[model samples]
Target: MTDTQEHTWGERYADSLMNTFGQPKLVLTRGAGAHVWDTDGKEYVDLLGGIAVNALGHAHPALVEAVTAQLGTLGHISNFFASEPQVRLAEKLLALLDAGPGKVFFTNSGAEANEAAFKLTRRTGRTHVVAAQGGFHGRTMGALALTSKEAYRAPFEPLPGDVTFVPYGDAEALAAAVTDRTAAILLEPMQGEAGVVTPPKGYLAAARTIADEHGALLWLDEIQTGLGRTGRWFAHHSAGVTPDIVTVAKGLAGGIPIGACIGVGESGTLLEPGNHGTTFGGNPVACAAALAVIGTIETDGLLEHVTALGQKLRDGLAADPRVTEVRGEGLLIGLDLAAEVSAAVTAGALAHGFIINNPTPHRIRLAPPLVLTQDDAEAFLTAWPAILDEAFEGQS
Candidate 1:
């Protein structure tokens, strides 16, 4: 069954799908907890966790049940009338962020979340925004403007303007870039796409001070680091600075696709009615899914679990001489190999019943679900050397 289906599915995917994402690496059939079964019934530990979107692993009972129940009850209200889940989810995001007096603007993804936040910043009557180098907010026009990658920006020229890029984790650079005309200073508490680059200590606090000094809003993109993914409700919490605007998505709905743009204090009321809108932003099902994701996080005590498991993973991965360094917190782990075999390592892991990501030439990223087990961590640790051996031999 496996052999017969594998070849056919692979061929069909190549023939039918767009060439944008290269090839369909695997046609996954089903998932449960931290594992997924491919079209050919080969199972792999999904350490990537849908690129940190699957907060509750795959097909968690609570997520399925909540989404199912909400869809049946009140699925879409067209944004003309709000539902319980929408309001509750917004309030929940504010509470988790622990910022006082905020409002949430829902979106379908991280890109849209930034779009909404970008629009809100315009309401400050200032057009300028300062963001960090090595930052990735999203790919939409507005968010892409804030993103610093030259290749991504060069192709999509004439993006929405009045944007400046400065070095990340340098408060002095940020201060130099910002001014009274700046509407907001955008940052990621941890730059995930830059291979899990954690900012220097006191950076967020410094941003907060700088924003205040220049009468600009401090905006933090927590899309990749929120919802206990970093062993905290929001990664900025560890920095102990309050950001006026926060964008979140990724793991909020356990793969259901939802994002929120939160504006704190006076920033919450910056966008008046008719300032911006969305079609499916705060749909009930998505909010219910987010509720279920957050509920499960609290019920499972997964925060402590992630913190403990992360230390274990970092220690284990760093023990390998081939692994030069390990970075990130909680389940958002990244490591740099001594050689440029990240692509080979990614392929080797898939062949060895594990799924991980190679975000760069020399970097491997592991963002397993909060539900990833001690045994899975230990298994990966035990197989680290063998995986490296295979990667080197295969790529050599």
Candidate 2:
């Protein structure tokens, strides 16, 4: 297809699709490995990795085979019956979390998974939840209440109230806000949507101590940083603290839609029968895809690859003077630009055959696939200075 045809499709997209996400960036037709081609056949390295959802990269044979075989055998079974893949995936997640005797509630997306967790917290016989500023749980009502972004929560006022927002990474503020009345304390091990912001050392451990003191459930939103994205089974692993509740999605199924709310120890039994339910939450096909993703990560050792490549990319990206700071772990990287040129930088990267994200005016984030090649990383670093130059020039 030609550029003109691609432009025509973009117009059609504007006409047909909802305006929630604004204009489409590119009309992507297909992807393979860590690369994608737009409708016009323009090739680009996918540094964002479908916003960190494509764990094994595009068209991974393991993911494809699993989804295909499962669909052929049995596709959607309502929550009335049990499926092998669903139970197996649940067990696998528990093992990865290292949480003994937990329960799992699967959902179709991150927001839905968070919704399930939110509902589970309600069963604690308390109504108050304490979350952190700059933390993003999801867009749903219950999850939105926990999210601290005023822009996201403003239009939808009168949200489910009794939620408190505290400064992230500040154990003191968290301790002050959380008390015996609090039902749960929610946090993201690494704040992903906030430009991959990392918390202070020992913050998660402090949260665990505080939650325990108040008899509040500790919940970590690991949707963006879990399942080997942070070079471990979970980001909080490095902190060596176990959360009472953990929400995971966005790579759980490697690209297939799946999310899970896991409750550890006694918290696992909080949501009893008839407390909550979903129609298509634990679909067999999605569970099978998740199993394949977990199996591949364990067998192929992508975690080590992500760790080494991430360090290489971070070191290289920071070598440029325009980068003020670099943060995050593994493939989930965020860098601060010297100026508010992240939008221009992202545009310039696309023009130079790279895909990136600008979550804020001055923050450029990269959550590339775990399977990204070293060659691709080197190429991006090689082009980094030029991309910065073009972006700054555009700003001027």
Winning candidate number (lDDT): 2
For 92-198, candidate 2 gives per-residue lDDT tens digits of 99999997789999999999999999999999889999999999999999889889899999999889858999999999999999989999999999999999999
Off by over 4 Å in 1: 2-4, 394-396
Write the residue-wise lDDT of candidate 1 on 1-396 in tens digits: 667678888788889988868877888989999999987778999999999999899999999999999988988988889899999999888888887898889999999999999999999999999999999998899899999999899999899969999999998999999999999999999989888988889999999999999899999999999889989999999988999999999999999989999999999898888999999999899999999999999998999999999999999999989899999999999899988999999998999999999988999999999999999889988888999998887766
Cα-based lDDT for every prediction: 0.92, 0.94
Clashes of 1: 0
Clash pairs, model 1 backbone: none
Candidate 2 residue 10 C-alpha distance from true site, Å:
1.4
> What TM-score fits each model?
0.97, 0.99
Per model, state how many residue pairs clash.
0, 0
lDDT of 2: 0.94
**Cα RMSD for predicted model 2:** 0.8
Top-TM-score candidate index:
2
Q: Name the 10 consecutive residues with the lowest summed lDDT in model 2.
A: 1-10
